[model samples]
Structure formats: structure tokens, C-alpha cells
Target: MSLLRAGIVGCGAIFPMHAASVAASGAARLVAVCDPDANKLESASQLYGCAGYDRLEEMLERERLDVLHLCTPHYLHPPQAILAAGCGIHVLTEKPMCIASADGEAMIEACRRHGVQLGVIFQNRYNPGARLIREALDDGSLGAIRGARCSVLWSRSDEYYAESGWRGTWSKEGGGVLINQSIHTLDLMRWFMDAEVSRVEAQLANRRHPGIEVEDTAEGLIAFDNGVNALFYVTTAYSHDAPVEIELHGEKGTAKLTADQAVVTYQDGTVISRDRLPQDAMDYGGGAKSYWGVSHFKQIQDFYRSVSRGEAPVIDGREALKTSRMIEAIYRAGRTREPVLL
Candidate 1:
């Protein structure tokens, strides 16, 4: 089988991961990369031995790519995706999907009109540990999930945000921690519960990084349509960096997963725990725990299979809209200091 030809936009911090994934997948090849910065393009091209262009149009015209991965800043997601779709290329955009619900809708419409597949990079949902929890939910082992909580209490130094031009700015990066850092956890929470958030009440604060234009911390209460309630807390200001933890409470049992380990306790006196059973690592800045980079590869391979089989991608554009809508509702709730209904 011929490998899928992939082109990537925005050769920034996350570009290497996508490049590595394409290289490792064997199902796809990084044919080209596009970035506004000549230096970034040159460096990434040299590193990956792929062609690079300073503009998307040039790359598209030159490469005839089978897939276009939008690894750009938050604000660029919608436009880049639309353009990619228009060029008759499937799109794989990094999440938050888009900065707003309207933009996400626009991207979806563009893809539908062009008969192109659009997927968001919510690789956390692809982790084996996460999939196990989902399996438990499906089998009713978690039984009538009552409530859930996800905490993305990770810390980011000022230098981390300073590494890029669009790091902490609202116009470029959308919101702060909630959009950039906590979005994966938020997506995971929604996926694990398999519920749509019907309402949200939130409070956002610039508690630590006053230098940034967006919230550094946000807390929200989410009510799912299935009568499941969840509390979400995300902050980049924690003094001690903590792993993102998601806990699901059920009538028969409760499952807690922190850093890719699953612990479950049941009403019938069954307690089981599983450790790092070949799960994708979170994209924390290099460490023993880093797994985000490789997971992108897994998702891309899945996308290729979906394309070949003429099936919907695992995290299709429409499915991705749910996460973006919830995010918008949270922001609205935070701004209005009241519950926002879906």
C-alpha cells in the first residue's frame, strides 16, 4: 500500500511530535511542512528530511498531500483547516478544535462541502488506559456513573509561555490553561462519560500569570444530559505540579486514573488496580511520563485506516464540536458568572 502523504503546518514546539508520528507510523510520510518562520521551517525540514515551505499554498501546490495536519496556534485552526479541505486534503487539527464554536462549525461545513475528512487531535481518548475505562463504562462495571471530576492542576513556568509568540495571548492562543493545557482532560472527561454537557457554571481567574491576557485558572460545574454531574478544575498556577487526574463515580464502582494508572473499587467488595499497561504518555515537556508525541502517530494511523475504509475518523470534525462547545459554554459561564445552557 502506498503511504499517505502528510503535510504539516506550523513547525513549532509540537511539530516534531507529528513528524515523529508520521515517520513511525509507516502508514504515512511527512512530505512537506509549512511555517511562516524561515528558521523554523529550515530546522524542521533538516531534522525530518522533508520539504518545507513558508506558506501553505506553496506547500499544497508542491506536495499534493493526502493529509494536512494543522499544528498551528489556536486561532489559525479554523482557517487552516478550511483551506486544507478546500485543497482536497484531509485535515487533522490539534485540539480545542477551534477557538470558538462558530469557527468549529465553519471548519466542519467546509470539510463536508469538500468531501474531505476532518479530525481533531484528541489523542488522550486513544490511550489504552482511557480505553479500558471506556470499556468498563460500556460493560456497566462502572454502573450508572453518578459524578465525575477532572483536575488538570499542572504548572507551567513563565519561560514555557514565553517560548512562542502566541503562547499566552487570547488573540493567538485562544484562552490560557483551559484551552491549551486542560482541553485534553476536558475532552477525556466528556468521552469517558459518553455524555453531552447540557449546562455549565464557571469562574475564571488570572490568579498567577497576570502578564497573560487570559485565565490562568478556571473551575466549572458541568451537568450532563444523562443526569451525570461533573466538576472541572484547571490551573497552571499550582506550586507543585500534579498529574492530571480523572475520577469517575458510579453506583456499583468508582474508577480513578492518575497519570495512566487505573484503580477501581466496587460495591460488591472488588478492588482492582492496573499500572501503565501500554498507554500513550501525556505531552508533558520531556520526562519518563511523556507520551503525547507517540500517540499522535497512533491517531494518524487510525485516521488513515478510517479513510481507507470510508468510515468516520475516530475524532471527526462534528464529534470535535462537542468539546469546543463545552469550552465556549464554560467561558461564557465564567464571564457571566451564571450557568450557560447548551
Candidate 2:
């Protein structure tokens, strides 16, 4: 098959991973990159041997791209995605897809109208352990899932937030722990449970980070459509960062998965345990790290495949809207100090 031509926007911290993936993937080639910062664009251009532009319009005009990767700030996601879709370019956006559900819907609608594919980066779903667990739940190995818990206790210092102007702002990064850091685990939670949240009650605060306008910690109770309840706790203020852990309780047994391990215990004395392989680059300018270095690559490859085969991406724009809705509901719940129905 002919390689798909791809362009990347916002050559920030995550751009290298995407560039590397594109360079290594058989299905796509990194043709152009755009960033407002000249230094970032030059660096990416040097490293990836691709043309770089300081503006999206220039890049779009110069390159014949099959896919456009939006790696910009949280707020730029919707507009950039829509722009790409309008230009007849398929889009692969970073997670949290968009800050607002309305924005997500607009992007999806624009893509649909333009006949372009829209995919979001939820690479954790591509993990072997995640797949195995999902398959097991689908086959009723754990029976009816009744309850679940998701905890993402990670740390990001003040310096981390200071690295980018949009890191901790509500207008830029959207929200703190929930929208920026916890969205991955939150997406995983929704994926694993295979249910939409019916309602949520959340408490959020800027506990540790002093200058940030958004929450550094968030604790919430989520009720899913299947009558399963879940408790979500996310914080970037922990003194010692810990791995995210998820526990799912079912009618017949319970399954527990830490950042690196998965364990299942059945009611009939059957116990299974396996090491959960990391499927994405977890380290984003931090001491904490993850193993899935090629996750973005996997996502891009899958997109190229989908385009070639005329199939849908794993995390399409519509599927991503659910995550955005859940996020908005959580923030609303925090503000109202009461449960918000989704």
C-alpha cells in the first residue's frame, strides 16, 4: 500500500513521539509540521527531517497531507480539528478531544460533512491487558459488572505547570487533573465499564498548586447506565507519584489492574494474574514514565489503515464526545456541589 502523507501541528512535548511513530510506520510519512514557536518547529524539523511551518495555513497550503495530527493546547483542539476537517484532511487529535461537548459535536459534524475521518488519541485502549480484560467482560467471565473504582494519584510540580502558558488554566488546559491528567484513566474507565455515566457528584480544588486556576485534585462519584457505581479520585499533588489503579467488581468476581499488573479472582477459587504492559509514553517531562512509546504511532498507523480500508477509527469523534460529556458533567458537579445528570 502507498504510504499516507501526514502533517503535525503544535510541535510541543508530545510531537516527538508522533514524529517518531510516523517516521517508523509503514503506513504513513511525516510530511510537515507546524507550530507557532519557531524554535519548536525548527527542532521538530531537524529531528524528523520534515518541512516545518510556524502557521497552520502555510503548512496546509504547502503540503498534500492525508492526515493532520492536532497536538496543540487543549483549547485549540476544536478549532484546529474543524479547520482540518473542512480542508478535507482526516484528523487525529490528542485526548480530552475538546474542552466542551458543543465543540466536540461541531468538530464531529464538520468532519462528517467534509467526509473526513476524526480520531482521538486514547491509546491505552490498545494495550494487550486492556484488550484481554475487555474481551473477558464481554464474554461474561466476570459476570455482570456491578461496581468500579479509578484512582490516578500522580504528581506534577509547579515547574511542570510553569513550562507552558496553557498548562493549568481553565481557558487553556480546560481543567486541571480531570481534563488534562486524568482524562486517560477516565476514558479507560468508561471503556472498561462499557457504560455511560448517568450522573456525577464531584469535589475539586486547587489544593497543592498555588497559581493554577484549575483543580489539582478531584474526587467524584459516578453512576453508570448499567447501575454500576464508581468512585474516581485524581490528584497531581501527591508527594510520591503512584501508578493509576482500576478495580472492577462483578457478580462472579473482581478484577484489579494497576499501572503494571492485572489480577482477577473468581468466586470459584480461580485466580489469574498477569503483568500489564505499558502501552504509551507515560513520561511527559516527569520522573514518572510509561512504556507505550509507540502509542501515537499505533494510533496513526491505525488511522492510515482505516482510511485505506474505509473503516472507522477505534476512537472516532462521536465516541470521543462521550468522554467530553463526562468531563463537563464532572466539572458541573464540582461547581453545583450536587450530582449532575448526564
Candidate 3:
């Protein structure tokens, strides 16, 4: 009924996006922030004019927050979210939800046990092009699914991994390209297929980034039970942060997605294209693109609505579990050099 008071943990690179989104949303306001890094916490407090704490537990104790937004590192997500849920604060975490499925399940259980909501931020779902494709499928205009191919050619240099100690390590940031850079694509693929992934065969390589523990590149194939199949190639060793592309093929039509643009072709060769959607201003200050315009804000508003209405978020913990499980499958397939059947 009223604006949800919020606190954010981890004032790192993605922290500003979440802070700004919550600040802009009519349904929420960021009242506090937390980070292990004192400098980051101080800077965020100065920027947002909010109280800052070094420990999340302290903030939870000191502030009567209605929501806790987690922009922390991969491995820290589960414990932090579970802690917040235990405090009766709903959680909205950035993806890939957590590094492991067990952590995700535990986080879900904690939230359920405390009677709070758990939401994951896969803001790509709010992208205009993605919404168009999902609408087509829901309306039966895309016909039955046939297959898909997703490509993420974004680049991450050696310095990118070296700059952060927690990143590029399996124990900390999880896997490389698939989990970090292209997880939204993976989620999109799962969303487009609209079915459980039955099998995965994958290969991983650390070609460009020197001394990185995880793969800078990965290639994988996924199969769904009803015979629909998809191929995925992702790498952070490319020339730049290029537009992500996905081609969706259905029985009677096809759709091609590039960033926030889409092109659809009917069985009779009639074509429709959406190439002129309003674009977010480019901010390459941190190398990677900030994100699609207003996606975080849109999702934040929706999550607040879900909390108020006793409904699940558009992308809840269970949906995020699918993405994590797929990433795990890819890694297992690569390590064993055999298809992992799920």
C-alpha cells in the first residue's frame, strides 16, 4: 500500500543500477546500503544520501527495511538473501541467482519459511524485443517451437578478471562466460523453449584470458523433451561488448532478436521488424553495457507489486533455479566430455 523501504547490499559495479532503479521506482525507496568494502559503502552513502553499514546484519537490525536488494558477488547471494528472508525482508537479487543449485534451494526455503518473497533480477525479460517474442508465443502466432540459437560475443579482458579478486574463480564467481556474461541469454533461451532442458553437451576453453580459472569461451547444445533443440556459443574474449543475438525458429514462423530489436517472418514470407525502440543511453564507463533502458526499474516496480499482492515475482527463485541448473549442466557436460541428461 505504501512505498517499500529498501536496503541494498554490495555497492559494487552493478550497485548503482539497482540503487538508481529503486530510487526511481514509485513503489520503493533505498533507505540504506551495505558492503564489506568501507570505501564502496561510504561512496554510495555520499551519492545516495542514505545510511551505510559494513555488515548486512547490522543494517537489517538498524533499519526497518521492507526489501533487501542484493548486488553482491556470485557466492555471497544465497547467504545474504537467506539472512534477509530470516529478518522478514523480501529479497530481490541480481543473477545468475547463486553459484549452485543447493544454495538456490536453501534460499527459496528460507524465504518460504519466513513468508517472504524471493525474486531474481533477469531484467532481460523486460526488454522490449524479448517481450515481443514472448507475446507472439503466448498468442500462438509463433507456432510450436522448433529450435533456437543464442550467441553472446561480448569481450572481457585479462585485466577484467585481474581487477577483482573474487571474479574468474569457480569457488567465487562461479563459471565464466555462460554464468556471468551470457546468463540472460541462457534465461532467454529457457524462456523461449518453455520446457525443461532434457540434455546438454558442452565444451569450454580459456583461450584469451591468461591465468583465469574459468573458461572465457563455451559452446553448448541443449535438447528439450519434445524434440526441440538449441545451440549456444558464448565468449568474453571477443573484440567488444557486441549485441546479443537469438534466432527462434517455430513450426510456422521465426523471429530474430538483437539486443532490444526484433524481426519476425511469417510462413508466407511476410516480415515485421522492430528496430526503432527507444534505446538506453550508452555508458561504457565500466566496459560492459549498463543494461537495457529502464529494465531494472520496470522489474523493481513489478516485484514491489508482487510483494504487496501476495503473488510471486515475474522471475522468482524457481525460475532462476532453471538458469542455474542449465549453467551447471553445461559445466558438467564440458568437464566430462559427455552429454548431461537432466
Each prediction's TM-score versus the true structure = 0.94, 0.95, 0.95
User: Which 10 residues in a row give candidate 3 its minimum summed lDDT?
Assistant: 281-290
lDDT of each: 0.85, 0.85, 0.88
Distance from true location, Cα of 136 in model 1, Å: 0.8
Q: Flag regions of model 2 displaced more than 4 Å.
A: 276-290
Ranking by lDDT: 3, 2, 1
Best by TM-score: 3
Q: List the residue pairs that clash in candidate 1.
A: 281-291
Give candidate 3 misplaced runs (Cα > 4 Å): 279-291
Q: Which residue pairs clash in candidate 3?
A: none
Candidate 1 per-residue C-alpha lDDT over 1-342 given as tens digits, one digit per residue, 9 for 90 to 100: 898999999887777667777787778888898998988889888877899899898888889999999989999999989988899999988887898889999999999999889989998776666777888889988789999999988788888788778889978888898888999999889998787788999999988876688899999899999999999999999986787899999999898888667778888898877655444343433122354535676787898888767777979989989998988889899999999999
Which lDDT tens digits does candidate 3 get at residues 1-342? 578999999988888778877877778888999988988889889888999999888999999999999999899999999999999999999998899899999999999999999999998888778887888888888789888999999888788899998889999999899899899998998898788999999999998987789999999899988688899999998899898999999987999998778888899888877653446543323233445566777788899899989999989999999989989999999999999999
* List of clashing residue pairs for candidate 2: 279-292, 280-292, 281-292
Off by over 4 Å in 1: 278-293
RMSD to the true structure for each prediction, in A, is: 2.3, 2.4, 2.0
Model 3's lDDT to the true fold?
A: 0.88
